[model samples]
Target: MSAIQILDLSNNSLSGKIPTCMGSFSNLHVLDLQKNKLYGTIPGKFAKGSPLRTLNFNENELEGPIPRCLVNCTMLQVLDVGNNKVNDSFPCWLETLPELQVLVLHSNQFYSSVWVCSKTKHCFPKLKVFDLSNNRFGGPLPAWYFENLNAMKDVSEAGTELQYMGEGFHQDSITVTMKGFEFELVRIITAFTAIDFSNNYFYGEIPKVIGELDSLLYLNLSFNKVSSCIPSSLGNLSVLESLDLSSNKLVGKIPWQLTNLDFLGVLNLSENQLMGPIPRAPHFDTFGNTSYLGNLGLCRFPLSKECRSDETLQPPSKLEDDAKSSIGFGWKVVLIGYGCGMVFGLIMGYLVFSTGKPQWLIRIVEGEHRKKGRRPNKKRGGRRG
Candidate 1:
């Protein structure tokens, strides 16, 4: 019926192309057919006055470029078509949607660098989550692209009120890449910011402008051809939680400035061309050997290879650790025995002196000497006979 707005047949065995007639539901807003056996491109027959707000075609066999007609729906907010066969270039035009919040084109054949639409102001200014990982995007990360991520720059309180990806008629859920896997987030809040551009052929220095995004919580640029020293400016991200730049050609020392990130929990700079001593701060120390593996040129605390100057290294080692344990046990035994003997001697001496040389107490003290004193007399008598 034209009156029906919400349609959700996702995760079913439905097959064949999405019915073009379904687009005639001018009142229809949310369409969710993800994780089904659906094939063919999205229908391009939506009405110009389309009220579609949320469109998710994730985890299907849908291929080809996204339907350009869907852009007619000016009210589009969330577009997630990840893990499909869609082979197309960057959809910079999607930035025109004023209310678009979440865009996921991960694990597809999307290629080329991202560009700004107007070049005068930010695009996707309200975008909270952007994932383009596992694609064919190449070239140095565009400077303007990072500059226009205005949403990533805006800091928000972590304990904000409850929220969801979309507020309109939708399936009420979407999948996002968290850490290194596809995770379905049932609810999303304002402070849940992340960027994952891993598994691409992107090369060149990571833009120092990335540090300007103070609200970024998770960032993964692993499995790329990125090179050059890590920008010391990244230390400015005081609240960032996870950072993965592993399996790249990145070189130079892990900046000591990174120690300033007190809230950093997960870090993987491993399998890189990095050298020199790793930063010696507490936060850097928490990460283990795996975080710095494959860097045979590296030296310092956590790694097995000691630095040229071991003064800066203070990693908890096994040999010295065993010595400390042995000394601790030996000293404890001595103290207990000495304490018991001192208490007994003091009590006996106090009883004899305080009781005016009490014979019983004095005899206990003199008993040893009395026996030796009598033994000498018996020896002299036997010698005289």
Candidate 2:
């Protein structure tokens, strides 16, 4: 293998194909057969004058069509073949690799309406990191395809906001025209560039000019079928980090100005059906509860629940009349201590049965009832003596 430069047959148990005589190893730069079980078609003579920069056939079971003669290896950089089963499209012949940068074709089957470049004024020109995540690539995301990548500003640095085109706004080539769409200006400078057209089937509503792409970071359009709301101009991206709109069908609220995306980190608005309240701040108070799981009309403060009356944490009415005047003063102090313990136990049972029994136990029960009431009071007082 001409003193192999770097040929790590990754996770080997290597199966057929891939050995077009290892392209006569003209100093193979790097070729790692990732998670192998490799099948066919990837050796168009290792892209002609092979000095392959870095190529990893990820999780393979490789199918056809990705070897457009490896774009003649114009000093090919990194091209990762993600979880493969590679079907074709969008490989626009590796955008004519001019020292091609990192480009990972995610979970393949690439059908496409976009991603075309063959130097139409400048495409992939020294492209910086570009990922086609979870492919099945649909429409609407092609504002001049990375705005004529003039060597993508020598590997990223300008304005930013290329990551899958969430909210828009990039200035440079001067092609404004919002709403009806039409923006360019070299995608405004060009440092940021992550594009993941999430779990297929992309639908409408999510284009509030992607907040003019002020250099976005990561943005994922969660399991698709996208509906309305959530476009509070994405709080103008300001270098956004990660924002995933979970399983869609999206409804209202939750736009408390996206807490100004202060370099947000991984915020997934879970399963979506979105309602009101939730949306405190400090980026949703540091998000937890699995980023608002299955949003059942979302309540406030970390979803412990309690915010219905048309939500937004409804409370005022003088704070619900001061919580019903402190629950009516705790039921008027428990009904004045149970009506003063039932009038002090009915005045101690009316002075113990009207003060009749206790005169030293009534003189020992009147001497045992004067011997049984003294024979009925001494035969009626001894027949009146």
Candidate 3:
């Protein structure tokens, strides 16, 4: 079909190699062949100037490196080739796709550092969602990796109207691990920005620049070798709902500023080097012990291990007592003021009335009689005869 614009044959039992002549479909804009028994490497027949926009070849027996010719499909927006045996390194060239938005390379043989760009100049400018979990990607977590996600760095994008991903008939889907659970998002939204690098060999500190992504809704970097203090800058994520940094070497006090995340509903910081008292009250009290487990240094609230008097510096219970004391002190001041005012009123009244006032009372009565005497008698109505 030369005029075929959308070709979707996913979730099927079909087996065999992909057609090498798919490039012949000059008008094809969407191609999906995921969740099948297909084998062999992807054909590098994507002709130059092809109008392809969405390409999906995930959940298959496909092997070998991704077709480098995909770069020719400059109009491509979504590329998902996860859950296959595709042995390859991170596609540093994909950064050139001006229209690319979503990239999923999870559960694959993709390895090595994804630090393609040294500067944040022109990499994944419009990308909203990225998933590289369960891969062989390793090395230090570079701060530039997050500094370049310009789409997520803006807080205003969250206010934009949400739009579903994918084109007509064929919907895009990605399986993401969030808050320690794998969730497959079938109908993704444009405002739904996430980063999943879990189950990797990444080490070193999670970049502080990561906290600059204020528009990010979900962030997962669990099961890695990340260490050092969890940056307090993460409190700036006003829209973040799910945050997973568990199973790392992170240490130091849980940043109290994290309690500023009013929208955070799912938090997993278990199995880290965290210490000191957990932040108290309001947002933090809601989380279960699963969030602070394995970190013996993390004490108080939800955890049965009580910290020393110095360790639990400002526990929630103490904060409550302070609030109550302040209220009581304010009430005491108000009562004292009221008593003083009442005594003053009594004294004023005593001074005004206790004075010899018999003359004043008589003058007031005389004035009323004088005014009455000055009035003319009123004639009865209807008495004219």
Each model's lDDT comes to 0.81, 0.68, 0.85
The C-alpha local distance difference test score for the whole of candidate 3 amounts to 0.85
Ranking by TM-score: 3, 1, 2
Candidate 3 per-residue lDDT, tens place, 1-385, comes to 9999999898899999998887668999989888899998887888889999889898998899988889899999889998999999898889888888899999998888888545547888888889899999999988876787898876665557776777455677766776656677888776788898999999988788988898999888999998888988898888999999999999999987789899999999999989998898688799999999999888889899888888867634447879999999999999999999999988867866778556776788899999988855455433542
User: Model 3 segments beyond 4 Å from truth?
Assistant: 116-120, 167-170, 315-385
Per-residue C-alpha lDDT of model 2 across residues 1-385, encoded as one tens digit per residue:
6878777767778888787877657888777777788888777676467777777787788887787778778887667787788998887767767877567776789886554444375567666456665677765544455455444324345445454311242111112221123333333233544445576666667777556655556567777777888888777776677788888888987776677787887788889988778766655588787888898888877878778666655323346789999999999999999999999999867876999565775788688977876435687788999
Task: Flag the better candidate by TM-score, 2 or 3.
Answer: 3
Model 2: weakest 10-residue lDDT segment is 170-179
Which residue pairs overlap in candidate 3's backbone? none
TM-score of 2: 0.31
Q: Give stretches of model 2 more than 4 Å off.
A: 2-19, 23-40, 43-79, 82-85, 88-104, 107-134, 137-199, 202-219, 226-240, 252-278, 282-385
Candidate 1, residues 225-294, lDDT tens digits: the string is: 9999999888888889888999999998787778888889888888999987777876679989888999
In order of lDDT, best first, we have 3, 1, 2
Evaluated against the true structure, the overall lDDT of model 1 is 0.81
Of candidates 3 and 1, the better by lDDT: 3
Q: Which candidate achieves the best TM-score against the true structure?
A: 3
State every prediction's TM-score relative to the real structure.
0.76, 0.31, 0.79
The model with the greatest lDDT is 3
